[model samples]
Target: MSVIAILVLDGLPGHHLTTPGLVFGTAAREHPGVAYEVRLCAGPGPLGIGLPAPLPIAVPHGLEDLADADVVLVPGHDGPRAQPPPGVVDALRGAAARGARIGAVGTGVFTLAATGLLDGRRATTGWRHTEELARLHPRIEVDPAGSVVTDGPFLTSAGIFGGMDVCLRLLAQDHGERTAGETSRELLTPLLRHADRVQEDIDRERAGSAGIEPTLRWLKARLHLPLTPADIAAHAGISVSSLNRRFRARAGVSPPRYLLRLRLDRARELLLDTDEPVERVAALSGFTSAASLRRHFSRQTGTTPRAYRARHRPATSPAG
Candidate 1:
């Protein structure tokens, strides 16, 4: 049995409090062999949750409950960048130091970032505050484009149903793809809607960027090419180090990491939109070989290329 502790804070969003339980509960119902205990912990106080109607709630567990948790999750509080109350950050730091996998959903990423555990680690938050998060915590590698980012043991997600994405990822990690896929199918409609909405948000964010937009357009046009960081730097007319710094500051990732993400996104699109063979898809996605594509895809997505294609392809499309 795995114990998952949620640190509830005052002014936390109501959905953020429920999302994890909903996911874990659904997973448990689907997989009886997997047992999980979810505990809501917080410092002693009346915690207020913000929903359409604000409500006051109380939890039985305290910060000590996190001591035994296998995973410590932070929910998004009401404020965009408010620090967690006294003792919360300390407890989170203690949990992380003890090897507990720490995750933050939505603005909760700000709370985790405030603990300094996410310093030098990749994280994302609500689309509205990605720049604010980056400005507040320059040491942390902020990834605005990803729906969910897992770096080391720290996981962060952009707001809205991005929390669901994180939970799906957690389910995949805890059980396997079979269980995660079943659970995903159960929530397919909402998940797809969430993906579309998040993509629109990301697209808007990118469209508003003046400096990085042209470079992004150029890179997207050439995603099929096996381009190196030096190639990108030369094309941008800047040193590799300068390119890295500019990308990290403006786009929230290094050039190579961003390129890899772009290629992966293209590969996913190809897998869904066309009945292309894995080898051909790999070639068009700038992967050197199908083997390499499969390796990286499985590592990043927790599913095989064939499974991903099968799962995502349109119903009218023939199986590849």
Candidate 2:
């Protein structure tokens, strides 16, 4: 069984404390041979969680427990910018030195950054605090766009329910995409939906209007179809040139670029969630052929479809 050490700090949100167990427990229950032991570790103090109604928690495990963990998770807290408690940073550094995969959820990235582990690495926090994180930690390349950013073994996620995304990602890495997808479905959490929501948030911010939302929805619904600029323009009741101008002004990309991104996202989801062949995945995601999917997937993600699947899925597992 993989041991997950969650470093609980004061001012922690309630969900951050619970999400890891919820996700991992579901995975273990649904899939045989997948097990995780989650331990809540903290520095010497009475830990108080910062929820709407604040609650104090008694964490039995101390910082030393971090050394024995396969994965260390840090969740967002209210006082993210504040320095971590005594011995917290050293404990985190020790865990990383010993080869534990560490992850930060939401503002928890600040705590991880405090240890200098995230220095010179790509990371992200809640969109609201991306600017602050970048300003504070100039050494860390803060990506404001990604819902989850993984640089080597250290992973950081955006704010709020980003913890779920991080845990799901951890599950996918440890077990396989099939286990992660099943667990996500069991929890009624769609794996790709959060990414889609993040993209929608970016679109709304760039477009500054709801006018493009309908078009985005239309494009997503018809991702399996060979959609053209003319089809998109007709759907929006505009000429191709007007559609291009509107997409550029509002969505910050041309219609073709935006559609390609959507198709890529769909292809990635299919690759992870299903056992469909590359050719079928390409057709399902609106790519013209397997070669088209391979070219675009490689350009965007830096890996071929088979390599991606092999890297993400366990070799011991049978292919469907």
Candidate 3:
């Protein structure tokens, strides 16, 4: 059995403490001969002080347990900007030196960053803390796009549900894509959010803003049509320059890029949910042809449409 040590610090979020068990437990249950032992290692502090009120629980393990652990995970805490608890940094460094894979979830990246292991490595944290992480650790390359960033044995995630994504990725690495995908289905969660889902999240945040809500709705409705920046500008009753500015400000991309993301999202949905041929999927998703769809799809998702469908589509679904 692979031993996973969870280094629990003060102010640990509730979800961070449990996600590993949720994922690994399901994996072991589903796959014969696969086993994982998850241990919660308490940091230097009075335990349970940071958890939600009236739900304190005891953690029996301590930092020494990290020495033999195959994987060490540090969950996000409230005090990322502050120094880590006593001996935490040295313990983490020793674990890494001994060939243990170390990971940090959310603001926990800040804690891991304190050990200098992440220097000159690409990492990510919660989007809100990306700038702070960059400011504090100038040597660590902070990538805000990927929910989970892996450099060598050290992994960091954007936190919250991203914790699940990272854990699933670890599971995939440990076992295989089939095990990871089966575990994801059993847990009823996507292995990772597609790029379009990420863009939709940004759009949702901007949905309340009156400046771009109508245009976003209009764009989604006409995703299948051939559209240009001029068409989008006319729909929004603004000049092309104004449309570009608004899109950049609200959606964080140009109008054309935003539209492409919408089309990609639609294409993904069709590929997974329907048996539509590649040509038909392309036409319906506003790509000029199957070749065009394949090019853009590969650029964004790193796989051809047919391959993506074969990998992710349900077994019972008819092949297109």
Candidate 4:
């Protein structure tokens, strides 16, 4: 049984503020021996991070709480001026120095970065704030695609609910897969997301120009066809070279990759919805063959198409 401290600063999104209570409280129910001593800590002040009150509980402990914890969890907070609070930063620094694992949920990384703990560390935050985080801490590696990033004692998660994934990761590291899986069952965290799915969708949207958008709409319509980059470029009334440049500049990927991602997403949907064979699904997804589809799908999602389809297909109901 280890003590975990979850620091709640002022201005945290109400929903994000509640996630730790849900996850940790539920985890306590599922695993009796693996007790988690949870606390909501605040700095020394009556208003305490500008939280709305009638205060729920008097501040039991201040920054001193960090020193006794095995792990320190920081939830995203707003009104992070050019720097996070000095006392808050110092407590995190001291905790990390004493070998406590530090985890941040969402924009909470801002607080950790302010302490210089995240310098040169790999980290992530909400997708909307990835660039902002990178710009603020130029030395830190901000990975938009990663749900969690770990460098030494520091770990940071992407967004609000991503904290549960980080918690599961920590549990897996300390105990084992079974413990983490059981904890996940109790917490109900999303098991996994295809690594590039979100990025691919964003890439597709920003990759093309206004003229290219109409052509992309057409390409999506004909995803059943094995359309080439040259064909798409021609449809956009641009040379393949210019179209490639535009996509690279805007979305940071090539046209062909964008198209593949679109087809793959549709394939995933169809796999969930229909009982199509791998070869037929691949053809409809614009992949040249089943093996090719499996290769790319596994690369992107870490799961084979057949396995995913089998797991996701809905069980049929009998007519009443």
RMSD of each: 7.0, 6.4, 7.3, 10.0
> Where does candidate 4 have its weakest 10-residue lDDT segment?
311-320
Write candidate 4's Cα lDDT for 1-320 as tens digits: 78778776766656555666666666667766666777767787542333333233354667887789998988777665357664888899889899898888788888888889888667788877888988988999786654666656777887756777777766755654567777776655343355357757766677533346677689789988878888888888889998887765654447886787788888887776666787888888888988998887765444588766544442522110
Tens digits of per-residue lDDT, candidate 3, 95-172, equal 999988888999899999999999988788987888899999999988755467766788888887777877887886
TM-scores of the candidates in the order shown: 0.69, 0.70, 0.64, 0.58
lDDT to native, each model: 0.81, 0.84, 0.83, 0.72
Off by over 4 Å in 4: 46-58, 189-320
Tens digits of per-residue lDDT for model 2, 68-150: 99999999887888888999999999999998989998889999999999897878888778889999999998866546777
Candidate 1 clashes between residue pairs 3 or more apart in a chain or in different chains: none
Pairs of colliding residues, candidate 3:
none
Q: Please, what are the lDDT tens digits per residue for candidate 1 over residues 17-119?
A: 8888888888898888977898999997677888646899979899999999999988888764665787998999999999898889888888999999888
Model 3 C-alpha RMSD vs. true structure (Å) is 7.3
Candidate 2 local accuracy as lDDT? 0.84
Query: After aligning candidate 2 to the native by TM-score, how far in Å is the CA of 176 from where it should be?
Result: 1.3
Q: Which pairs clash (backbone N, Cα, C closer than 3 Å) in model 4? A: none
